[model samples]
Structure formats: C-alpha cells, structure tokens
Target: MVGAIILWIIMIAFLFFILHAVIQSALDSSNMAKNIQDIRDYLYDTKREGRTDKRAVAEQLLSTQPGAPQDLYEECPACGEKIIQHEPECPSCGLRLKD
Candidate 1:
C-alpha cells in the first residue's frame, strides 16, 4: 500500500539523517585530535630547540578562532614549560601545576 511505502520512506530518511550526524561528529572529532597532536609535536620541537619564549605559540594554540580556550596553559612549575590545557600535570616531570 502507498501508506506503508510512505512510512518506510520516512523511516529510511530518519535513519539517514542520524547516520549523517554521527559521521559528521566522528569527522570533527578526528580533526580536533589531529590538530591537538600537531600542536603538541610543534611545542615539543620548539622546546627541544631551546626556544623557551613560547607565549606566541601558546597564544596561537589558545586562539578561539582556532576553537580553543583563551589564556589557558599547562605551565610547569619546575621548568616553566607551557603546555596545552588538557594535560593535568607537567609532561616534563609529573609536577602538578594546579591545585
């Protein structure tokens, strides 16, 4: 019957929308993870090169235009290394930066 066909079409369309949304979310998360990894690598390289003045890089990393928090850092109390915000402790030493 036409009614049954219409119902099936509607269900199919709803399923498609859900699938599309899930796929989009996955892609967004992947991109964000890749970006975070890239920033971490860049920061490590900069630190290894003896470039301690990383305020600029931190600023760039925290820029909201890049979808990150502003003025947030994972500063190490021991060596004063500026790291990303998500890190609970200093990557260099296991020192807790925040209380």
Candidate 2:
C-alpha cells in the first residue's frame, strides 16, 4: 500500500536525522578535548623551559629600586649578590663580609 510505503520513508528519514545529530555531538566533544590538550601542552613547555639557569636568568630588583642608603644593601664581592646590611653574610654566595 502507498500509505505503508510513505510511513517507511518517514521512519528512515527520522533515523538519518538521529544519526547526524550523534555524529555532530561526537565531533564537538573531540574538538573540545583537543583544545584542552593544546593548552596543557603549552603550560608544560613553559615550565620545562624555566627549569635551568634560574639564577643566571634572574635580576635582583629592589623593592624601591634603591638609590638611597635606607633601601640600599651590601653587594657580594664574589657573585655580586646584594646583601642586606643587617645580614652578616652574603645569602646567595655564602661569603663572609666585613661590617
């Protein structure tokens, strides 16, 4: 019968619609996972690159960018590390200092 044939066509169309929606949902999930993975990789690379030569790559910036005696500190003779006037020895190089 024509009615039965039409009913079958509608059922097949509905199944195709469901299949298309499932495939689209899967693709969206995959894309979101890929985006998260890329962000994790970037952070990991930054940490790895900063693992070595931390001292050499560093600068001892003063809190007030010292120009006066109040904020000034002693400098290390061996490694040029700044020593607070109150500190008896150089913290960075562990060298003894004269008061």
Best model number under lDDT? 1
Instruction: State in Å the error of residue 71, model 1.
Output: 34
**Candidate 1 lDDT by residue in tens digits, 30-86:** 967778677888788878888775456656556724655555765676888877675
Model 2 per-residue lDDT tens digits across residues 1-99: 999999999999999999999998897689667665655675566468875433322222223233434655667889988767656677687887765
Whole-structure CA lDDT of model 2: 0.65
User: What is each predicted model's overall lDDT from 0 to 1?
Assistant: 0.74, 0.65
Error of 1 at 84 (Å): 30
Backbone clashes in candidate 2 total: 0
Give the TM-score of each candidate: 0.33, 0.33
- Determine the C-alpha RMSD for candidate 1 after optimal superposition of all C-alphas: 8.2
